[model samples]
Target chain A: MYRAQVRVRYFEKKAYDLFLQNLVKGTSHLAIGQEAIAAGVAAALRPDDYVFATYRGHAHAILRGAPMAAVLAELLGRQSGLMAGKGGSMHLTYAAGNFLGSYAIVGAHLTIANGAAWSARYRGTDQVAVAFFGDGATNIGAFHEALNLAATWKLPVLFICENNLYMEYTPIATVTAVARPAADRASAYGLAPIVVDGNDADAVYEVALAAVARARSGEGPSLVEAVTYRHGGHSRADPGKYRPDEEVAEWLAKDPLPRYRERLLASGANPAVLDRIEAEAHDEVEQASLAAQGAPLADPAELERQVFADGGATWRR
Target chain B: MATLTQVATRTVTYREAVALGLAQEMGRDPTVVLIGEDVAAAGGVFKATAGLLERFGPERVRDTPISEQAILGAAMGAAMTGLRPVAELMFADFLSVAHDIVANQVAKARYMTNGQLSVPLVVRFGNGAGLRFGAQHSQSVESWLMAVPGLKVVVPSTPADVVGLLAAAVRDDDPVMFLEEKALYPMNGEVPSGEHVDQLGVARVRRHGKDATIVSLGTMVHRSLEAAAQLATEGVECEVVDLRSLVPLDVTTVAASVTKTGRMFTVEENPRLCGWGAELASIIGEECFYDLDAPVRRITSPHVPVPAAGSLEDAMLPSAERVADVVRRALG
Candidate 1:
């Protein structure tokens, strides 16, 4: 499982970098640091379990088994993307993987996880849903409401907040006046909270295993806050003026992916094997990037297709 | 068409009718389940889902926390996972809280997934201002949802339509917003028992009068029928069309009605400007332009916040008198 995490991490980074390469315009938020949460959560999930994320969702999408080409195409706004380019970065979906969507709205997809969990329980499916959001999302109203509902209903959902400290440059301390860490907000919902080193893939994997187990057993929802930091600014172009130089250096020393690689190499796991894994993932991502560039564009004329359940509204006029 | 009794006659309140539809659907199909605030115990504030908790237990008849967004979103999640979920937004006015989940998640999941995942999910809620539930509680916000893509809005007028639309919503491979008028929960109608899958976009020709067609839905359907009866005695026969579902609009029915009658009027209790009536008027006026003897008229409530006082409510809302007046002017 640990080795699988490293391979997925490499795949995610390679895929994301390739997606960035194919970008015609706009920015991309790379999950370079938060790879463990996706891999760990994916490891704990079954094919029927559902997952949702926000705009910074590439890692989750890739780890959940969305084809590299499909996701890259989405980021590139190509027709072959997960959502056929309709959703772009935020709304990519791989339904067959039980991946519902990557909502653009902050703290928006939690409600979806709650809804799906209730449904799974009703159908007697041991399927659970995983909602991945940023620590910044914890302060949002939907976050509070979603956790409360999940706890109250005992819905099978694992609410994971990748607490990277800042919500688009607004530091966590400024928004949530709560005295302790924001992950403790889960406690108010009467849900058991597990705060782990998000940079450590094994730690995330263990916490995710427990949460997914509880959810599948119909016990209820749980919250897991993976504390990590992003190496770059919130989005592209903004040079992250908010963080002090020392803080960036401090977090860089704790980079999760590199630390995992070092540990694997120290354990005598052949460095060549790790290099081979990187090569394969890198090659796959490069191919996907090429594919994204050549992917089709949605026909401009079919813009109104599938907008409504019965298509666009029609009247006498 | 089918004999009224044979069609499906159940003496059920609108609330009971909807609940029974959900219970029956959930029982018959394991994929179906309930997700809402108080749907499990307290059997919904309207008591539609009474006895659901004990019968289905907590897992199936799930009670969600007071987060409409989460309720709607969870329903989307569950649906994508292959469970057909029926979520209740206790009041239609509260759909605003869960708008993104319903509009973006549940609505677009299937289409975005290239139809790989079908959101067999229904968001059931009550909308209207008659309950004196104050401004926050009494809003017919269905117009907001009708504008969103990938959503099928169903407003059932009769108890029969409630059963039929809801059953179809649960069984159909799509996302449906099922709106019930809060004031009309007690109104009874015949619901033919078997084969309840009524096509959603087909508006019913409730009364087949020839002078002009009055398009209405939910409570307004009853008001239109009453207006039609009163107008009939005055030799001004008015055809009333019940738009059971708003999104998959049976514009064909409205088109045929306007073509035959040469005039059309839209009636609803929702505020006048930018209301569903306005959309209906736009569609009708555009499609049946050559057939119209006069411009389409819309008889709707005044464009103002809902008044809390009962007397003011009646005055502010569209009444049978207003519908008749609109028809009279349209005919002239």
Candidate 2:
């Protein structure tokens, strides 16, 4: 769990650096401080389980086993990228890794996740579909619709809301009616409300394990709200100055990376082993960045490919 | 017509064909599932999907809440995975509520994922005006989907075409928007019994003539044939072409008819602005510019919302008389 969080942190930082160097084009939503939720939830999931994430999904994709180099190459718009530069950072999809997709539209993937779960149940498989979104998504129509459908149909799925307390530039508490966005709405769907500390990896993993087991057993869906924060801006553009300095400082103090390291050391974990993991994570990120930067841009002809299943963009003959 | 196989035939209404088409595909492929509001047990709001629930059972023919986003989104997700889902949008106008799923997620998922996924799904909806249901319930929105790539837009004119084309759409590897004309649901036509399937982009020449070519789709195809029959009594024989599918448009048949006739007219039910006929007119202008003896004409509904009153709607929508009059004037 520590290694996964460290790898996400290192990869996000390198991506931020690359953005500064103007190598990563377009926009990217970084999940620097919210790594524990991704790492923990993924840790409890089997490799074949389906995962649907939002645009801020670099951490989720990496923790779901998408190669770090290919993810970086995708952000860099390289030919060897995860989607051949068709989908940039915001739309990373590694279907082979069971990371179904990172949807850019807010709240849409929740309903789609229900479809995956429905497919699993129909096929007589125990595979659970997990959809990760932000607190703002809980207010969208698709979110409510998805919850209602999943609950009514008893679909095998989990709705994980990373309540970072902010909806883009505004505090979620200001716009939201209830104090807890996702957890507060669980009862409306007859689901048990679950809220966990996003800064604590172990807490998230435990919650995820219970939810996954319940879903696999066909107990319907679960809504889990992970209280976390984003250490960086919402995207590459904003500096996240809308947040109060004291709140930012408080969340930074609760950073999961160093906090986990401290917990491990106090628990009698070897210092050299932790050091090696951290060093290897850093080295992996560095090498991935180098490899992604060295890769060539996608061919211009690829623009007209794969619009349909026939592997062509031809709408008319 | 050339793409269809010889088989036993039975006369059925368009509404009955909708249920028959669904049952045919569901019986053949267990993966094909039907989902929508009132689609099961209640048959359907329009009674087009009657007997589906009892035929396929609740697990396969399930009813959903009045959630358009959930319906299309779940259908898209299921299609992306393994199941071939046929989602009904209830009304085509409701498509506006869940346009993002159709235009963005379903249409672009294959391209965005770089072919890593394929959304093999069909979104069938009740389309066009004629029921006096007013503006909200009536619309011909095929033009709305024609502009969006990565989607196959199919609007069948006859009962046989509905059964056959729906089979084609169900088995298609891409997402398809199957628009069923609400006005023609009660219209009876001969449909083949047993298994029936048709190609997606093949346009059927309903009536062959040489004086002029009249291209139409959905309910307008019947109106155009009526107009052609009327014109035949006036010493003018018009060739009527029914463009069953819009996305993979059968330009070959329409172009050939226009080239032989030396004139063309498009009868459309959609509003005037950016209608499917506009694209067909542009294509005709570009491809058959020199072959034309007269300028192409499009008899369509005025750029106005479909009104509730029958008289207003009849005057607004392009009728058989209007089509024949336009063709006569253009040919003269």
TM, every model: 0.92, 0.99
Model 1 chain A lowest lDDT segment of ten: A308-317
Best lDDT among the predictions, by candidate number: 2
Q: Candidate 1 has what TM-score?
A: 0.92
Candidate 1 lDDT over residue span A1-317, tens digit each: 44555555565565445545655446667676677777777887888788888878877777778998887777767777777666766666777777777777788788778877776766567888889998888777888888888887787899888888888888887877763355677679887657889888878889999888888887898898888888777876566888999998999999776788888888889988888877777677778777877878755644655554444423212
Q: Pick out the ten consecutive residues of candidate 2 chain B with the lowest summed lDDT.
A: B1-10
Instruction: Please identify model 2 stretches exceeding 4 Å from their true place.
Output: B1-6
Candidate 1 lDDT tens digits, B1-332: 22355453657788788877776787798777786778887899888889888988776787766777767767776777667878889888888777777776677766665555667788888888787777788898878888777777889888777877788878776788888899999887666766465667788999997888889988988889988998998899888999888877788888899899988888888887788888878877777789998888888888888878889888877788888877776665
Off by over 4 Å in 1: A1-22, A46-48, A216-219, A308-317, B1-10, B193-195, B330-332
Superposed by TM-score, candidate 1 places the C-alpha of residue B71 at a distance from the truth, in angstroms, of 1.7
